[model samples]
Target chain A: MARTAGSDGERTEAAIREAAVDLIARHGYEAVSMRQLAARVGVQAAALYRYFPTKEDLLFTLMREHMEALLGAWSEARPATTDATTRLATFVANHIAFHIERRSQTHISNMELRSLSPERLTFILRLRTSYEKELRAILRDGAEASVFDLDDIGLTAMAVIQMITGVIVWFRPDERLSVEGVTQTYLSMTMRLVGATTNRETQHVHAGTRLRA
Target chain B: MARTAGSDGERTEAAIREAAVDLIARHGYEAVSMRQLAARVGVQAAALYRYFPTKEDLLFTLMREHMEALLGAWSEARPATTDATTRLATFVANHIAFHIERRSQTHISNMELRSLSPERLTFILRLRTSYEKELRAILRDGAEASVFDLDDIGLTAMAVIQMITGVIVWFRPDERLSVEGVTQTYLSMTMRLVGATTNRETQHVHAGTRLRA
Candidate 1:
């Protein structure tokens, strides 16, 4: 319906989705409407209809696309290192970065997932399952290789995802904390939580040792 | 307003509030209605007016009371202990235990805070501010006493609270995991997160230590 063959149409559609995301993230999905979105986009209310058939469809579109984008970012940033510890750390660091970079997209995508249609809900869960599977594989491999200490690797992987993804709700880009610093903080915290003793344990044992410049 | 003099009326009102908590916690706050609460309480919709004046009033009442209860719990749990390390551990452990015991209450308290009237909303924020003041006092004391090595104690406290609170979304008491085990795990993770070392940290420092006991 959008006639999205040209860049102009695509741009218009993108604008609608952006407006939808902002409005939903601020006021929640149920409180958002196309007329409000149209006004925000500086378009006629009917113009939005060409792109999104209904308000719910618009929200669903935003969530589906956002989730896919998140999954895609993970797939893209995956390093080639076969070391499970490095791979898992990279996975978490990349995830924290993605959540910070696209906070609004991630926020609405998470909060509005409960309002999605059954089929779309299942689709989103499947995507999440794939995402979880990738993380679990690295964790499973780590546990097997004696690099990571974990019980029920699947649950530990899920908990790690939850802990990292939970960062979006509170992280502020304009704050004093640098992304690198926050990522290292979480990496250290998670390593200890999962009983990974390689670095943190060594540091604690040598608490009196000064770091080499 | 209907008579509030009798215990019968008080019991009915309490029942209605409990039902609202359950309904709203299962669905979101927006999706629940007075009629649904009435149905859940097995009473007439009009009779609900005998207790609370309006739908929004009921929501505000439940959320306001829940916050007060959480605040009360924190106050009752805090002891005048000499050791900052023991005090901080007690606080985090008690916070986790409260949530595990009343996950539904915390869920409602969080989800419905946005739905409060501005006047009631102030109470919510004031309550939160007081809670933070108390927690930060411990963190500051710990930092000053040389028991904690946190660069940003306030930010660290906020992160720890958010991380622990976020656990409610995923924890299941019926699982193979015990509540004590989960609490101990989180407590250990938290102590290590704040740079506090323990026997486990020393044990884990050994290169060949097994992960599980």
Candidate 2:
């Protein structure tokens, strides 16, 4: 597979964004200056400004792209099934994988929201809400089908998102558990939290088989 | 009962911490300056320095006290029951209440950790470990007693904490749901996630009584 290399301008812009995520994640968005970022990226300050007109613009671009990437990942990973349990499992797996791989970008996306302009903040939040709405829809459908039990779809969706996104907080690639293991455990927890009937059956078998050992 | 007033110095220190939490929460810790903080608290920079010799010292103190306050709150709210379900309920409720009440402080504590020096970061993380250890112990004991079902104790503890503490992210005093109501829903979710046998019984009763309506 022959791949065309990026042009020099495109490569410089990519380097700028990469360096920005690292510096901002380390020192925070407000503390990181465009000059410092350009210095780290080995580009002139003027070149950096050519890519991002302002500091806030850089932050907004990073945040917007992060959310867009997440939404994009979920769309690709979403299973072609009406079964809520399977759909939710895909959502959790996709979420944990996406976050763990881009820990720095995810951190900036979450923490730098306060620094975004009001209009930009609203734009990013709207993206977040739409992403969350997908999970809420799954919960709603599950509850209606009587295949899952939940007290509130909105709250459950938030809980599931927080609980799974937290994986990046403590997880390390060299750690004892592999990503697959962690995702499986979290998937079970999610299923149980929502009271999926399949989870209950699995739990019974697991308890019967494993508790004695 | 008669109350004693704090000394002027003590009141000034308290005011600085409050203002710092607000400012740091609004803008990242690296972006907030001692001069700006002193201005917010209506104190001279020298007076602020007399209380916290350096900006990092101020940040370290704010974070250290936040964790200490959380640990103290947990100790007070900890139930006297041997039952894991009851203890877990108390933990969830206390955590939600504590974070919700100190939203700004919680935000600063969670976000400003990267700004701490290595030693200070270790101290804060140690306090966090001790706090999380309590939840781990409960999960371990529950697993032994066969009251709660879980794949990983550490993972479950992290999930429950993140899920409950996330209430502060979206909750507001003027929201449609009361804090108590929100806590109840989370408690139920936590109970289900752990696969507490007691929760199953409650769920059956709840479903029988409420799902039909």
Most DockQ-accurate candidate: 2
- Model 2 ranges with Cα > 4 A deviation: A1-7, A199-213, B1-7, B199-213
Each model's TM-score for chain A is 0.86, 0.90
DockQ of each model vs. true complex: 0.26, 0.73
Positional deviation of residue B157's Cα in model 2 after best superposition, in angstroms: 0.4
Best by TM-score: 2
Q: For each prediction, how big is the interface RMSD?
A: 3.4, 0.7
Looking at model 1, the pairs that clash are none
Deviation in angstroms for A23 in model 1? Answer: 2.7
lDDT of 1 by residue, B164-192 (tens): 77667667866677666666566656665
What residue runs in model 1 are displaced by over 4 Å at the alpha carbon?
A1-7, A33-50, A54-56, A144-147, A196-213, B1-7, B26-57, B111-122, B138-151, B200-213
Residue lDDT tens for model 1, A1-213? 234335487788888887887777666677666788888888888888988888878877777787788788778767676877667666777788778888778766656666788898888888878888998898888888888777566556656777787676666756677666666677666665566647654433222121110
As a TM-score, model 2 comes out at: 0.90
